[model samples]
Target chain A: MSSSKLHPLYKQLLRAFTSRPSDLKTSGRLLAELKVVLIETGLIFPQTDYSTQDLVIAREILEIGAFWSIRTKAMPSFDRYFSQLQTFYNDYSSILPHSEREFPIRGLNLIRLLIQNRIADFHTTLESLPLPADELIANPFIRHPVNLERWLMEGSYSKVWNAREEAPAEEYKFFVDSLMGTIRNEIASCEEAAYESLPLKDAATLLFFRSQSEVLDFAKQRGWLIDLTRGVITFTQKGEEKLEIPKEKLIANNLAYARELEQIV
Target chain B: MADVEMKDAKSKSDAKDDIATPPLSPVSEIKSNVTLIERAVSTLEPRFTIRVLRSLTALRKRLDDKALCDAISEIYPQDSQVRSSLLSWLPASPTQDESMEVDPSPSPKTPSETVPETEIYFRLLILHHLLASPSTYSEAINLANETVQKIQSLNRRSLDPIAARVWFALERAYELGGELSDARHLFLAAQRTASLRHDDETQASLINRLLRSYLHYSLYDQADKLISKTNFPTSAPNSQYARYHYYLGRIKAVQLDYTAAHTNLQQAIRRAPAPKLAPGFYQAVHKLFVVVELLMGDIPERSLFRHPVLEKALRGYFDIVKGELPVSYSVRTGSLSQFQTTLSAHAVSFESDRTYSLVARLRQNVIKTGIRRLSLSYSRISLRDICVKLHLDSEEDAEYIVGKAIRDGVIEGRIVHEKGWMECGGQKTGYGPEVSEMFSRRIGYCLELHNQSVKAMRYPLNAHRKDIVDAEGAREREKELAKGIQKGEIDEEDAMGGDF
Candidate 1:
């Protein structure tokens, strides 16, 4: 109950957690120190000999680690802490009140899985959850990746496109944006098979690009001949120009086929 | 035994006073509780600290917020003994209720310690509650101003976290109390604190709030400047990141970056908190998204309108697109005045929400639809014919609109400006465009994949240690070469590119 009675490093870890330095470098150094303290004290890693207070401090450290890693966009770092926290939560959840951060973290994990295109892992992860998928779906965080995977598999490109605005979590957008990149390519192929060339503005709209500049960048990346000053994209003007088929041979073949049909009749 | 004797002695000294202080009023209750806690704090067990703070906060709820703030301020400096006692418990009590006052305890036992950072955090929380719901705007502004002065007086104790939280709360209060410029200045100061700490997440959250404040004040240039200077955190908490995207989306929409705007809005919507948590924010984003989609000339799916939460908000926009009203394409081109009148009636509600741009885009949507129909109905049409059919102001205007539609790929055609006719380019022999576009996009993707693999080789985490080993090896090699040269055994004919 006293500072002296607690783990020597507990006070230090608490200070870092509660008044985290604003500077990234100092914050990073503090996090590294916390990890070392946790490891040295056997609060993390294998031994389970911990007091209720020690466990509480360890959980606090892990939670903040997860938050900081995610904030820095360090997914691998975040992944380690989140898994540690997940195990901790499963073992000690009954002793503590539900953390508001739990569902959001779970939701973020689902999105990370979706982004990496690990659908199998995503399903397996969801299946192993304590709650039913139906109940999880009630949360916007869980619903987003689940719904996106469904729409993607179903070939509902529009639905996937529509999801851009309905993503349940912020990090979900990072995945959704990537998913859209894939969807756009698919749609572009379909449109190419069906039409000669769409208008420049129409192409931009159809491709879900929000600006002419973006469309032009994409067009350039695609090696399309775009006359931006005139607002027209000529999609078929590169190496295939020399591969045109002979028009006379096609007509003669058609005439011969008609004559052969007449003789058979 | 020492702890017990100290506790008894303190209780006996305060027992008569506690008995004298009646609990008839909430203020009296809080006062007595504070005194009792102060008296017992030095000898009190660390585990009981949170319980005491919770009781103080409970008493806080019953007292008039403004009166309680006044009372706390009055008692705060006068009771230095209690303040220092509370401070003694501070280092060991990070989990203490953040609303309770915990001063920098001048306990002789820990005299050399830096002020616990939580002291500033708790103080900021107190100031936030005071400014958050003051009975009047003047009271809120006055409280904010006073807190700013108080915080400045603690300049010597200004650590990064303390500075960041204090500035954030003060600026927030300023913004709420309708002082935009002052809020902007403090926001910049808070931003500096976050930046100095290299706290990307805090910086992004601050930027989002600042942008919202900027939007509210219509300070477009300032918002643009801030966004250009700030780097949005790619890996922040989804809620804060979602807000960043949402605010960015609104700014893009205003700037006519409809493409970027739609992307940001989509991210905003995707990352937006679920309906139960922040329904209003979700609904607002959805409304903007729908409007942006419409402006881009895409018909939103029927299912999108089926969401019960968004149905009511998007109904009017839905009706216009779905043709629940009798507005026809012919009417859109034939009578601009009549169309404007009808459109204004349907779009009036959006005006209040500053969606004038999207509402105005309705005409463009109508014109685009009319031109698409014409291309299907006829092979070629004179510019004059289009003007008459669509009821435009002049041939030039019609030509400009048609030309824009053509460039946008709404209609496949060439405008013969001299002949004053639009020649529709039919979809024949167009495989080359699609095939090439697809090929190029694939090629581009492959290049990016290659680049990413090359970049992944630069992992700083492991690279630093590796670099040290490499440096040590190079130093050893140089030492051996120097020894060889000293013995005159090195060949002068060695290759020029060899390691020195």
Candidate 2:
């Protein structure tokens, strides 16, 4: 719990975190121990007074934990790390040196929100950024997701698919892949609604799938019938339900309006 | 010129009188305000307290260390510790005449018992005074922290109104000291207590404080979460409602919900104090309102720019709204270069107003106008020519922009992708379902307005009783007139003339 004791544990965490191939098991254990030590020293929420060196080490440890959590795909733990790091990032920002990993983590959080389809939360996060929009866009890490969001809104699926190669970080590819999956499903639904039948090659191209087999498998999952004789996929339309108008409610609403108008007059 | 000279001479004499009787009038005013607050507590009516608060703005300008010190000593008993502690926050008086006369003054004291409401009120005044100077900001923060703790511990229902004011001063102190987030937990805790006690005034003030702190840091998500988790009491005063609506409008606007933002901003404007009374708030709300309206693809009314309080502050926004400047004229004419020049020219002001992002989004509107104009002028235009005319970067960008314009219904055209040309469609006649739907919407709005007005109409209390009394009086008068006519004692011409 003391500062001297924390130094060794932090060093060990750093080693485990930086080792080739990323020793997740050992580093995870070291991270938990370091977190306990940091919390005991009042460096997490930092209620008590702490020395500058201790605060810096504590912040770096949490930042590493955040990256490690994301690499391991433990999203809840990553979120916890993010919340803890906020105090250091915002409150003590004047005292501490800027961390290099701040923007990347923030960028990752934005992509995480996008992958979850929480567009409102994504914009809220963007608005909370300390930098201006142009400055944010100038950063390659933040620009990737911002461009993806704009392209997604514009219904330019091809731009998003091309954005996969332009991701700034390796972890970004994971979220981008999931986003592509959602986009593919959206495109599939639109294709079904707009088309009667399409050739397998065209469908594959439209869905951003390179292989014909992938398109066929996806088409099968969507309940489309594939005909080998014509080399095409056919969508069968379901029975259209009758549209029932709420006639009584409409009449009652209008009648109420009329009654109120008469009283006003 | 003679009238102006007389007015200037009168003001000069008034200034001399102010210097001569430094603490007399202001101290007496404070004493009267304290008496009013006491009466409010006894009557269980918050309006008297609000009246005292309303005069605080004028009283605050006259307050100095000497005046406040004298006022506190006069209000408190000879041996009151609250008196000494409140006096300690003020700087020692320098003038020998003022200090010599302030001590040992034979001012009448009401009671030895000091109410917590008066104590909190004094603290609020002292906090505001300390916040006026940058040097005493830390001291003000300390006082605010101590006062908050004292109020929480007292837990009296009568303290709610003054406590709300104390919280406002607390927010100001923390904000001035640049440590607003440090006091966030305090506000959150106080708000929880206020809500549990059902103290609507304090709760409303605390909510606005917390919202302001969150927004200062640009933490929209937290502010939005706080909004969702808490219910804003409708019984709160109009000032609190205006602040609530303004914060809500900011959040909604950033979230790209322009229609909701517009409505909330309009409510804020309606509920806000007169423009001269709160010019900063009036200007801030209008600035955001105009931006929201533009984002919604509607021009704000020209009259809005002519408001005296807003005319200077909203000059940049006015140029963007009305195309008054040559650059903005170019913007209205769909020149991309001109729009860029105007945006960069006023970018700093826009950034400071926190509307930079929203205004930047107007680029699409500019491009849409350009495309609409181009479509109207030329039935068939190649993508290359469109790009050259619009100052677009490339033919491909133009194609994509045109495609999006068509999809968004900004233009009626189809993109011939193979030939890389946009083929415009003929304009349709006005007789269609769209026109009918528009008419129906207008009718519905008018009916709804009529219904709302009828509901909101107010009638005098027990009005029918007055009508009954009038009818009885009329009957009596009729009987008297009949009796007089029957007795032949009334002249018909005289009665008719009098009646006419």
The candidate scoring highest on TM-score is 2
- Candidate 1 residue-wise lDDT, B1-500, digit = tens: 76567546644644544465454454455455444444334433222333434354334333333334444444555344433433332222333344355443233232322233333433444554455343344544554454444444444322332343455566666766777665776667757766676665456667877887776655555577788998876545576778788878777666556789899999888887677667788778887887777666566677878887878877766766655122233334224465465456765566555564445545656666677778877798998998787665567556556655665667877666446688887865657545654654665566556655665553433558988999999999888887887787876456234644
Docking quality class, candidate 2:
acceptable
What is the Å distance of residue B131 in model 1 from its true position? 4.6
Off by over 4 Å in 2: A1-58, A69-77, A132-134, A182-207, A220-244, A251-265, B1-35, B65-123, B146-150, B153-158, B319-334, B364-500
lDDT string for model 1 (A1-265, tens) is 3424335545554565457343444556666877777776676753565676777777777776776676577889988988888756765776756676677777777767766766545654554455532365577777776676655433345566777878654445545656677767655554443344557877776677888889888877767777767777766622534665556755665565566446446
**Clashing pairs counted in every model:** 20, 0
Candidate 2: interface RMSD in Å? 5.1
Question: What TM-score number comes out for model 2?
Answer: 0.75
Q: Give me the displacement of residue A204 in model 2, in angstroms.
A: 4.6
- In candidate 1 chain B, what residue range of length 10 has the lowest lDDT sum? B105-114
**Model 2 lDDT tens row, A147-262:** 88776654456777877878798778667667888888766765555345777877787788889889878988999999978888877865654555556755776786678668
Q: Candidate 2, residues B1-500: lDDT per residue as tens digits?
A: 76567546645655676787676577788888888888888877777889989888776756667668888877887566566566767786553223332322222233565566887888888888787667788999888888888888788888887888899999998888998898899999989999999999999999999999999889998899999999999778899999999999999998988889999999999999999999999999999999888777677888889988989988888767644233222323355555666677888899899888777766556556667778777899999987787666667557556766665566776665446688897886666545645765787888877766676676754788989999999999989998898888998787889899
